[model samples]
Target: MKLLRRRGAVSLDDRLAALEEAADLADGRLEAAAVAGARAVVSRAGARRSLSVDHTVAALAGATGSGKSSLFNLLSGTALATVGVTRPTTSTAQAALWEGAGSGPLLDWLEIPNRHEVDGTAGGGPEGAEGMAGLVLLDLPDHDSIELAHRLEVDRLARLVDLLVWVLDPQKYADAAVHDRYLAPLARHRDVTVVVLNQIDRLSPEAAERCLADLRRLLDADGLTGVPVLGVSARTGAGVAELRALLESRVADRRSWADRLAADAGAAADLLARASAGAGAGDSGDRAGAPRAAEPVKAPETSADALAGPLTSALSQAAGVPLVVAAVAKAHRHRSVAATGWPVTRWIRRFRPDPLRRLRLGAASAPEGDAVGRTSIPAATTVQRSQTDTAVRDAAAAASAGLPEPWAAAVRHAARSRADELEDGLDRAVATTSLGASRRPVWWRVAGAAQWLVLAATAAGALWLLGLFAMDYLRLPEPPVPTAGEAPWPTVLLLGGVLTGIVLALLSRAVAWLGGRRRARKAARALRASVEQVARALVLEPVTEELSRHRRFTEAVSEARDEVRPGRG
Candidate 1:
């Protein structure tokens, strides 16, 4: 029968365990000031290990002139808390400990210096007090006291008590200070809270009912919909039994502390959950309604995969991959033209520098040590540097778009974690990439040999013609010069060799231009791949790890938040 009634209610142990988990999740995500109340709940719950579970600590709290002390005395059946007609009574919190329970450590933790034992026959009828053996009733200073210290004492004890019985007078039942400062904030804590219209004897039955109705409306507006409200007169003892019965029921349960702490954890978790929802919706200032589902799940809007393209592109540009590939293509054409051009002008072309060697980078320039070495390439221009920085920041923002502030900050940190090493790392990556332009093409060697043969033929023909002219000039007998139909053989050989070499050089230049473009494209692809690898190692990996941490934290906090159902057990 008990299980059926408490089917959906979480056990005390489960609630405490969940509270512990939630507290850990809130450490950095929520501000320490914002989460202080929840941390106090966890700390008090742990402190309860040394306290007795059988004891129920209840406090009577009210604004000035509310008869809170009279109610406290009536409940304890003793004059422990002083009563006065003066505006403020009970400057410090006073506890009435029933004799059967040991509350030494509990009172010490409560920090109440004034305590009275109310279990003996001297105070009143022992039978009534005997039934409330494990109860510890406290009379707290007026919440609206003129003395700041008295109000501070009330505020302090208000948080430590297991159950709060707010005592209000008929006239001041709708006071803004009480409802705004206390009741509204404790809306989620209604399960462990009660409101009593004290000194109800001042009003007739109809007037009492009307005041109660007005108070109920205020409570509902304050977000305390189902909290129990009663009417009682401490002076005439009318309706005092009902208030005592309520306290007795709380004491009998022996789970008031657990329920209070559980509700506290729930309220704190709900605040965080709503804030996160508002952030995910892109309106961080909005106050989201209470979570409707049992489990609160956060599906991050931006994933690591979505960050790859922008990050890689930025790193590629930062690494000077485009400039390096352009140099490779130019160098390939320069070397090819020099090797396969006509021999007459090839030596002059050699005076110009190889574009790749000018940069001191290529497959040949990789550093020998594990430390990344800088390339001798020229520094990026101011515009290029600015663009790189902008790209990195944009990628970080894109990767953190829908995440909570903490997670977004984490992603930004991860993206820039190795920023100082990026210039050198990217330079090293470019230096190590294979340009494929290093190996000379076989056709260049063959074409060079052909050019040399043409040069030799041209030289031989010219020498034969010079010998014939010198013999004629000396008036000596000359050998017969060969003839090719209408033209002299020496002149035809000389012209054909020079013209053929020029034509071959022109053809090779055209082929080199086309092949150089293809080589440039290949080099670009290879460099981009290397740049992508560098991005993954330095930037994407850390962002991915942060995302994983965020997912785990969300799940843990969600589990804790889901465990504390406000109206449920």
Candidate 2:
């Protein structure tokens, strides 16, 4: 029996621990803590040794003057607990130990100092007989005592005892306070409770039988019908031996310990299951209604087009015609040269600007007197601060509208906050966008200047060489040497000037295109980050919070039940 009780207690503790862990995972921390506390209490109760005697340990509990003490003394063959006095006498718990192996540890754990070690007299018998071993009789204080300590002690010890012998005299057996406060609440523990009709000696046999039947009916009404009932008289010892024999049988079997622990665990499991079910119900709302698919709207695509158009237009205009056309023409020329032109020149031009550069329309001026016509050049529109801000705000609002109520509000707030951050990023992007603006690196400027100088020097050399070749080929007479102020315009020099202007235009366009792409990438990244933040705030966060709140409410309900009815079977 002792081994079984310990095992049962361990099993119950494990179940309680598992329940608490589940509660924690479900975000019911408060409930989990409560369950943990309950588990600890139960573990302590389980660890406390069971009565070791050969007889079954039973506690006789009742209201004041119910003759429970008198019945205890008559059964244990000693006047250990005070009786027969009108004054409330049993202040602390008292125990009567029949010859037993396990009674001492259990009594010590119960903190019952007063003990009567019975020998082979009264109900005591052979050390290992049905009536002798495993019995630890407890005379608990009146549960109805006005003294709070007495009631508390009685209630505290009630949970640990194996069998509760509720002794009630004929007069107060049907008392409302007793049945409502004690019996009805203990309905879950009915299997371990045995109601005894004490003081039946005062009634005639027929009256006693009728009273016993009425008591049984009351117990049934109290939801305790299945619990055994015995009519007895402490003064006459009527039915005492029968009760003793029943206790002996219970002790011999040793299954009641496990049964009691299982009952406790089962009750706890039921409560936990209900809580889990309630949590599931709360979560089920997600699947209850028709799935509300977000209606696809054409407006977002339109808005994207609207927003991108201005920026693209601005880029095209900033990159003028001389830059765009010249870069494309140069790339095409380079490709042709690489395929059919001299190998040495092809390698040299490999470092030259490609067609993609023309798309960029870089910030560079055309050569003087060689400028492309304004009509052929696309002009870039300067982006206004206010216009960009408005566009961003509108986009954020459009996304926020798709969210649920409270979440929608939170999304709006987040959008507004994030919009400010995005605007700051946009400002930085714009500031960094122009290659020739305040953000231009020193190396780029130096490189541009060096390239221009090299082109100028090359043009001068080409002109000089072309002039020499033309003079030699035409076999023209050396005309009179002209003064520096009188020098004629050389066709070769003009052609070289044109070529240098073309090279500069192409380089400018390539730079502009690269800048545009970089800005576009940055803008796209910022937009994506902002959208993700809004989604989390508006959808996921709200759902998680609601689920957590539901868990807490369920826990509160459980706590309320426990408070209203402590020491449940």
Question: Each candidate: RMSD to true structure?
Answer: 5.8, 14.8
Residue 207 lDDT in candidate 2: 98
Question: Tens digit of lDDT per residue, candidate 1, span 1-569?
Answer: 01122466555455445556655655565455434545666677678656776788888899878899888878777787788878777788888887635788888888977888885673336766666778888888889989999988888888778899999998788888887788877766888999999887888999999999999988887778899999998889888877777777888887787677666666655555544443321222311222232233454566555777777787777677778888988988898889999999888988998888787765453556755456778777777777777777787787777776766777788888888877877887887888887878888999899999999989888997898899999999988877999888889878988998999899889888888899999989888888887877888787777666667656545544545346665
What is residue 169's positional error in candidate 1, in angstroms? 1.1
Off by over 4 Å in 2: 1-10, 19-28, 31-39, 49-56, 124-129, 201-225, 236-238, 262-569
Q: In lDDT terms, how accurate is model 2?
A: 0.55
Clashes of each: 1, 16
Per-residue lDDT of model 2, residues 1-569, tens digit only: 22322421334434434434434433432235334534544565456423442345578899888888988877777778788556466777887776655566777777888888766765544543434466787899889887999999988787777778899988899998887767765565666788899888999999999999999888877767588889888888898777777777776676555555544544443344333333321121221122321211111112333334443332222333234334434444444433333222436766765553434333343455553322223333345435444544454455444433333343344435544343333222232232322234343455456445645656675676577678879998755433335543454444555566456545655654565455445434433333334333433244334334334433433332222234432
Candidate 1 all-Cα RMSD: 5.8
> What's model 1's TM-score?
0.77
**lDDT: worst 10-residue window of model 1:** 281-290
- Cα deviation of 263 in candidate 1 (Å)? 1.6
Quote the positional error of residue 255 for candidate 1 in Å.
Answer: 1.7
